[model samples]
Target chain A: MEKIKVKNVFKIFGPNPQKIIPLIEKGKSKEEILKETGHGVGVNNANFAVEQGEIFVVMGLSGSGKSTLIRCLNRLIEPTAGEILIDGENIVGCDKDTLLQIRRKKMAMVFQNFALFPHYTVGENVAYGLEVQGEDLETRHKKAYEALELVGLKGYEESYPDQLSGGMQQRVGLARALATDPDILLMDEAFSALDPLIRKEMQDELLVLQARMQKTIIFITHDLDEALKLGDRIAIMKDGVIVQIGTPEEILTHPADDYVRDFVQDVNRVKVLTASAIMKKPDAVVSRKDGNKVAIRKMQEAGISSIFVTDKERHIRGIITIDDAMALLKKGEHSFESIINTEVPTTSPDTSIVDLLPIAVDTKYPIVVVDDDKKMLGIIVRVSVLSGILGEEE
Target chain B: MDKLQIGIYFEALIEWLTNNLEPVFEGLRTGILALIEGFEAFLLFIPSYVLIAILVVLAWKIAGKSIAIFTAVGLLLIDLMWLWPQTMQTLSLVLTSTVIALLMGIPLGIWMSQHDVVDNVTRPILDFMQTMPAFVYLIPAVIFFDLGEVPGAVATVIFAMPPVVRLTNLGIRQVPEDVIEAARSYGATRKQMLIRVQLPLAMSTILAGVNQTIMLALSMVVISAMIGAGGLGEEVLRGVTQMEIGKGFEGGIAVVILAMVLDRITQSLGNTGKTK
Candidate 1:
């Protein structure tokens, strides 16, 4: 299900915005429109849908209307024209009460600057959404604590915002947004104000939380690396219009325009490209119950140095080199278990290629990609990882 | 040619108000008098010693022990100089006018903060109210309420109300934009935003406004006394009229003592509000 759909939304900031919106749709440049009508174009025909559990990123430089576009989704900045459908309900035309209800029940936003109430304690700030919804005190408190714990801020509940560091305060901001357990989270440069190390930690924390909760999120940022790292699908905006929307790999490999190409040019591909992007299907494999002769034949036929040995469930048991398999066959070994080498390095499919660099450097055999149950999914050799970074096809 | 006649319109407006709103003026005069009389009676009913002790304790609790000691000595000096009754009268007048000012000013200020048009319209009116001599309003006050503490309080309220209204509007408007947006994003109703986010965050600034209102009200005491209001101002007026230097010094000292004590306490209150 689509959690949010923003269709051809226009946000013109000036008197008689409705009249100026037609100029925007007629392909007038922002400067031209401003010159003609004195209207500032906030978002020019923004259109996108956020699928359930997807993290959709809107990336743009300042004044590109990224923030304005995100604000329009929750009707914080009302669109001059067009529809914003959240779960199929167009909120652009919602009445004040209905808008409030939807904002309280369906969406929560985190700001670039942690917009914590200075007078409020951490717990009170976190519980604010619930309090505004008129939930009873006990439930608000309980949920507040749960949210704080989720964001790794359990005992700092009674502390004022000023007493905490900027990073800790941002955690409180995140907790406040999550306290209501709203289905969609709107993060407008939520980590842009934090220092780099803290911002990285927060990004990892959000990813961990997303894995568990699967909440639909619309994250806005100007940093290409952040967008590539965090976005399931990224929308690059320029001059109040979305220029391109694609997955991180697709964006890196095939930029939509000169601006997008320039944006991706300096990005660290090893950090952005995951192991799955470069990993190939294993050429040969041997079941653990297979005799040495079977393992040797599979490796020779596939022209591989060794064969990965797996159980009936495809759980990687070990690997057997062709030389070892031949020696075992001469000894008349019924099983290849004695020749199996268990020390080959393994990585998850989602691990960034940069993180796998050292492991790849140390291992002679192709690195195995495994799921949580240790089932072998694919293999990544050095050349594939190198070619992934070089943007070369193999 | 003929002289410009702006004063004629003013006179007509005042005449119309007097004639048509007689009952309203009477009700206001009665209400103000009753409040001042009640406060004065309460202050006098407490044994002088008990009142001093309570004030000392309140100063200590709100400001600090040093301020409490200074307050005790100041009040004792006023009593020793036989100015206790007059001081109590001044205190009562100041308190009544301030309460009235707050009652009228805060809501107006909040309304102004929400509506730019109202703020713009009243901004010059506030300037006129502030820059006009305190004695000028006494003419209308006396005409409406007839030369007594009520008229005195009316003049004081008009003189002191501007700062509170202006500051309250400023405080509410100065609440960080992001904070208000955060509240709005959380679905806070307008009333909820005002009470929970705007007002609480503006509290320190508003309390500073209150302090300014009280100080301005105190400054009006001598002017109000020209309309036959009794207080240290009457003593100062008599000292000036009769050319008695001792009496003038006593009244001047008493006024200073009261102003300092009130200023310290209210400033402390504003500071504490910010920390909370």
Candidate 2:
């Protein structure tokens, strides 16, 4: 189930995006609209939905409206034109009271810099969101301590923000956000301020937290690797619009446009794609049925290209010599898990034909395609991966 | 104590000794008297009382060149007025009160910070202490200690202690949250944190409070002298009573000089923490 949805989010940073809407509709450039009206667009027609208990990342360079988009989801910053649907209800016109209720109870945000109040102890900072929402001292303390315990800061309850290191302070920030037990976690580059080592640790900690808590998270970042490592589905954004929204594997192997392709070009799809694409057919079709050379000749001759251990018959079985399969076995195994060693060559159906061709060209194996049931559907030759790159659709 | 000025309090200790308590009280009494006598000796040891420039230069070095020049000119004018000796008496009394105020104020401030009860209980008292008229303190000092440098100095100390206490407390409290948390995470106890992190960070503000205390003490010269303080205050008193215009002018000028010099020196000391 989708937990939250952002539809046609346009947060313009001036008097009116309404006036500019007609120009945009007419396919006029943003430069032309701004030249006429003198207003800038922050986020332009962004649309995406996040599933419950998923880490849906929004990635862009700074000023690409990634932060603004995330902020709009929680209404921390208002969107000029959008409908935010949390659990299938529109929150576009939510009143102050309703917005406060949603913010306090459903979502909590963690900032880039650890926004722990300087005067507060770690425990107090963690408990503050609860306190702001009107929880009493004992209840809030218990909840805050529980959240701290979850983050492995159990004994640090009495320590002030200054007493902690940058990492520890961010942990307090995370714990504070968690204390409210919000249904959605909106983290705005929360660990970017930390050193590289600390950022890695916090990232891993967030993964573990997500695994345990299973809350819907909208993680925003400029780091592509962080997005890949954390996001269940990434929405790669550029110039305020989403270029694509897909799983990390999908983004890497099947990018939607030149922008997304360039963005994921550095990714190693050989490692990311599974083993269903490069497998051979299970029912080997032998052309000649008698002599030893005839069997090898038949295996070579058949365009179905089967090294058959069996036949298409009622419990039909055939004998296989070691030499008959050895030449073909060196090519690759076509399996779903890709749990085999890197020494093996295999590809998944999800692997882009363009990305899979080089390995195929070297090894001379068929590009295997499998169904959801792990049944081998067919095999694509090395030329198909190359052909797809050339815009020849089959 | 060296017993150079240890009075009968030292001798009668053994006679009244019911326990170790007698010696403790006697020891404290002797220590205090020794400090006073040491100060007295210090004031008199100067040859020609020409150490004033050292203070003047120090004030400039610490506070700035302006304070230094002001101090030098003020002292020169007082000497020209022929009130140098009387100025020394007034300086001694003001210094005595300031030392006592610091000795008492800082610990009370620290104590107040440590205990919520003490801070809450004493807040109103300190408010009253600061807001009340200066003469209200003098009446009690005169009634209990008799009119002299002792009562006058004691009264000045009481009158000036509140600001030192308040500033010290505020400064320590205002030390950044991160600094305190850093200390705590390092396993610093409450006392250790207070002494190490809080006190050092709060030093500038505390010194500012001390500077204010010193200035307040200096301003009390005529007030203290009116209650029998033996310094430039007495010179001014003489000027007023005898209707001697020459004496009054000399006394008033001497006072302005003393105030400027002390103000500059303490202010310099307070500001030294800044450039560093």
Candidate 3:
């Protein structure tokens, strides 16, 4: 089921919002409508549905209404018209009590400026959402502590927001949102305020958290690279309208318009694309139990000079070239251990292609992609990594 | 051209209020009189030296050592000038006015911050309260409370209340938009948002308003003494009418000392909240 679906959502700022919404519906441009009525159109007919456990990013430059659109999802900026459905329930026409309940029980948000309450300590800030929901003090504290640990801020609970660095403060912001255990997280340019290195760190941390939690998230960002990196599916907005919505690869490969094309054109794909996106299936592999003759037969059948060696569980041990297999056969060796090269280049599937480049340069063997258990998932050869950087599909 | 009968209309309005709201005025008079008496009695109950010691210690703790030393030396000079009782009275009056002003003004300020209509409606009224001569309200105050500390307090509260309201409203309004949005998105109820987020964040600014309110209240001491409200103001008034320059200077010096001590203490409080 779609976790949150926004349909025909319009947010007009200033007096007479209802009147201005009609003008928006009539296809009047934001600038023209603002000039005519002195009313700013914040979000014009924003329509999208975010699936459960998906990171649905809204990407646009400043004033493109991405922030406004995210705010409308939680009703921080009230939508002037149309329906917002959360888990198939229409939230647009819900009364104040119902809306408050929805916000309390269903959604929590993180902000761009790391809006950790300056007056509050990190733990207190994290506990704020639960406190507002009237949770008991003990539970609030426990949950807040757990959330701090989740965001890698276990010891900084008593520290004030301003005392921490900007990145640490944003971790507190993320922790606060996570403390609520809400079904959806609305991140409105949550990392845009951090320095570039910290921003990248935070993005990686968020992806790791999402992998574990599987919370539906609607992230907003102005940086195209950030969107491409974080978004499972990105909605590119322009002038309060969503110009395009697609996966990162799809957006990179086929931008819908000149605006989106311009955005993707400048993005450094080597840094944005990961190994997993371009990794090829292993043609042949010999288990630890396999004999030297079997390894040679498999490599010959696949027409490859080398093949990966794995245990019965598919945990990668090393690589064995045709010459090593031939040596093993000539020496009457039965075990593959003596000939297996344990110094094969390896990378996690999620490592960016840019990070893989140096390793890719020195290694003649394909880089082995593995999971946390060191179980081989796939292989990224030099050509695949190179083609991946060129925005080509293997 | 005939001049507008502003005075006549004002008199008639006061008369109408006095006639219709006599019981209400009487209750308020008793209430305000009790409040002032309570603070006055509390101040008087402590011996002069002990009270000074407490204040100096408070100054030391809150405002730092320099202000504390200044408070000790300055307060000793007031006692040396034999204005201890009168100084205490003025302090009590300032305290009473400040507390009352904050009580009424903060909620009104919060209301103004929440609603644009209330802000618009109260803004002009606040400006009038702030800018109009203090003497203008003193007459109605005296008529309503019948000439005593009550009337003085009423006038002082009216004169001093605007800054608290204005600053409270400004402080809450100035709370970063993103912070308020964060609170809302986290599902804080209106009251929770005010108490947990808005009020706590705006505290330093509101305390600044309180500082301004206290200063205004202290300024009204001499003016309030024109009525039967006795304080350092009475000494200054005596010095003025009887041509006792030394007494007036002594009274003025006491007031200045009191003002400095209070200012430093409150200013420090606001400053502490501002830092992380």
Top DockQ prediction, candidate number: 1
lDDT of 1 by residue, A1-394 (tens): 9889888899999988999876765778999999988999999888888899999999999999999999998888989999999999999988999999999999999999999999899999999999999999999999999999999999999999999999999999999999999999999999999865578679889999999999999999998768988999999999999999999999999999999998887664457677766777788888977777777888889998888988899999888898887887788877777778998799997898778888988889899999899988788888787787775644
For each candidate, give its TM-score against the true structure: 0.82, 0.45, 0.80
Where in model 1 is the C-alpha error above 4 Å? A268-394
Question: How many Å off is the CA of B9 in candidate 1?
Answer: 2.7
- Native contacts retained by model 2, as a fraction? 0.00
Q: What TM-score does chain A reach in every model?
A: 0.70, 0.67, 0.69
Ranking by TM-score: 1, 3, 2
Model 3 over residues A1-394: C-alpha lDDT tens digits? 7888888888889889999876776788989988999999888888889999999999998999998888888888778998999999998878999999999889999888887788888899999999999999999999999999999999998898888999999899999999989989989899989855578779889999999999999999998778878999999999989999999989989999999998887665467678766677789999988888999999999999999998888899999999978988898987777888999999987899989989999999999999899988788889888888787756
**Candidate 3 clashing pairs, residues 3+ apart or interchain:** none
* C-alpha lDDT of residue A344 in model 3: 90
lDDT of 2 by residue, A232-351 (tens): 999988877788999988998899999888777755543333233233333343322333444455556663443432223312233343353444355443221222112323444566
Model 2 CA deviation exceeding 4 Å by range: A29-37, A269-394, B1-276
Q: Give the alpha carbon lDDT tens digit for every residue of B154-242 in model 1.
A: 98998899999999999999999999999999999999999999999899999999999999999999988989899999999989999
| Model 3 docking grade | medium
User: Which CAPRI quality tier does the interface of model 1 achieve?
Assistant: medium
Kept native contacts, as fractions per model, are 0.81, 0.00, 0.88
Indicate the DockQ of the complex predicted as candidate 2: 0.02
Q: Judged by lDDT against the true structure, how good is candidate 1? A: 0.91
Provide backbone clash counts, one per model: 0, 7, 0
